[model samples]
Target: MSQEQHYTFGVSTRAAERLRSLAAVFAPSTEQLLGSLGKVEAGALDLGCGPGYTTELLQAQLSPAWTLGVDSSEHMLELARARCGPKLDFALHDVSRLPFPAPPAELVYARFLVTHLREPVQLLRAWSTLMQPAGRLVLEETAFMRSEHPAFQHYYAYLAQLQAHYGQNMLVGATLGTLCEAAGQHVLDAGVRVREIPAAQMAALHAANLPTWSQDPYARAAFDAAQLRQLGETLREIAAGAALAPAVSVGMGYVIATARPPALVQG
Candidate 1:
């Protein structure tokens, strides 16, 4: 699939602004995940790193000797470079592809990335080659989401459908451990972390993202323009604190695994 077709979300300025909010909302959980790594000698690779927020988190939490943020969009990479400066590196590469331009890393971190790719097990296997024999692989993905509000429910349903049309899974976190095992990694930890997100926070996120994908071929075909407009208005109202809604229950699946050592050889 072409790059445009691969990712439903556009890299427009609004999308970048959404990413900033995304980083703030998810930072604590991501920091907890990184803190579990303890120490890193070689450095960390932030796969699908948009705007370098996660890279900044890694540097702050782990103090890795070096850091590299990788993404497919040059526009995002440019933003990442500007945000991170010379202290960290940013590479433009489709993370789903193997043979990344950078060297092996001691830690590979991907947040909300696998859901956008096909054959996550294969992708995990390929990622192992980018890590040292004992390097750690960390991932955070959406397992499922729930909300009492009709607007949130409708938005998630349509978003899931749109992602499925592109051969991706919106709730891939449920199978993260199995994917790691199938990829030959030694699983360390795997479980879901549930967070109650305020309606305003989630509404802001959804509002920021709606414009990026509302015109997608799949979205347009599945949803009426009037329906999308109403959804957008509701989201904006909630985001602006003018409307009230129940908190959203988000189930985030996280996994920590290590590459199995190479087999021993005897002459």
Candidate 2:
């Protein structure tokens, strides 16, 4: 996918590395999601596997005979290759298209990938076909996120608008369970987890994301250059703990949904 198409975030070297760091926050939930998939065999697939951070976690948890991380960004694949072992290989392909040019995987995990699709349900059905019979599909996404910081809140409001323009959903995590059911997958488990990060970490997370979000031409068209620059400056201030912004921590809600392909009915 072109950078313009992925307006929410880009795949620059910096962005991919930052994404790796952000992935750490959800490591615990990711581990649980993998465990919920029960005994794993064959292989696993990490769709939209940025820098292979999640892939690394998968290797440690499931230790599948083969693991593949697929992403459209060659730059991200470079970093993923550096981090992953021979067992975990990466492929360069756009996820929006269907029919992955690889073997069917028994375990498929995708985090924060569906929100980008205009028709996530269609993508879900395609993903089901990629799964082996009774294979598991685990997904993590955000239901809602809010911050007390003025600059942060202001920036997010515009960011949401920009995502809408590109037909993306900033809060698609809320409906993941229903979407999974619609795809004919049996819901195994589903729940929400909330994270409250201190201003310092919040600053770090946004420091990486804000630049990617603001630098997009779509974002630029939505807000003036001065507005983005000010938000950037405020983010730095928050990271440095110099700003007198509200002491409230950044609150985020993540919904982790797990489902399995339905077994065929017997005669």
Candidate 3:
């Protein structure tokens, strides 16, 4: 999947609109929990916002609190803008090198973005600086257990490998709390939610197989015939199998790591 084809994964635009309600699956509960801690400051940054799904919600849920969505792919950014209704700002930016004017922000948010990141510590260091006193950096990420299917073990084994090959960041234990404390931020609170993404839906996503979804745009990015065959076999097993226990969906919430300057923490 080339960086350009990044838009092809997951739900359709119409589905995204309908399931826009589902998008709140993670943060709404999270913000409420964090709210009991304290109120978020005026403005927030939606880091690695992808298609602006969460960005749109951040605007409504955290109303009166402004948000900015940043993503690396121009295509994803465009789709995000289209889904969005002009309340929040969107920008094309690489997470490794965030492009915020002024200094940091009052609140920083990210969902399912950092796990695909290699230098997550670098990201924490950068975003932490974006905060003023008591400001927070929130993040969420997804993980899957590949050994869930005994019958289709080989199939999912290959699919998981393919996902990794395509440059997906594997942050096995880098949840917001773990990373925040490591990065010297005060860990306010963190939690995890386990849910089902539906094996049928997973099969559908594998079949749609967007070009951007594979990162195939960046020169010689086609999967080998063997790989595709294995993926097909994997999806087939998933569709046919009984009691596939691979956690269908899980979101780790690091929604409210109070931001304090490194200098302040040092003293």
Task: Give me the runs in candidate 3 sitting further than 4 Å from their true place.
Answer: 1-38, 145-147, 150-174, 206-224, 233-255, 261-267
lDDT of 3 at 114: 70
Q: After best superposition, candidate 2 residue 21: deviation in angstroms?
A: 2.0
> For every model shown, what is its TM-score relative to the native structure?
0.94, 0.88, 0.70
RMSD values for the candidates in order, in angstroms, are: 2.5, 3.0, 5.5
lDDT score of residue 45 within candidate 2: 90
Candidate 3 lDDT over 86-172, as tens digits, reads 766898776676456535667777776775565466567777777766577777665442335443354345444544564544443
Sorting all predicted structures by lDDT, with the top scorer first, yields 1, 2, 3
lDDT (0-100) at residue 226 of candidate 3?
58
Tell me which of candidates 1 and 2 scores higher on TM-score.
Answer: 1
lDDT digits (tens) for residues 8-63 of candidate 2: 77888778767866887667767776666666778889888888988888878888
Better of 1 and 3 by lDDT: 1
- By TM-score, rank the candidates, best first: 1, 2, 3
Give Cα-based local distance difference scores for all models: 0.87, 0.73, 0.58
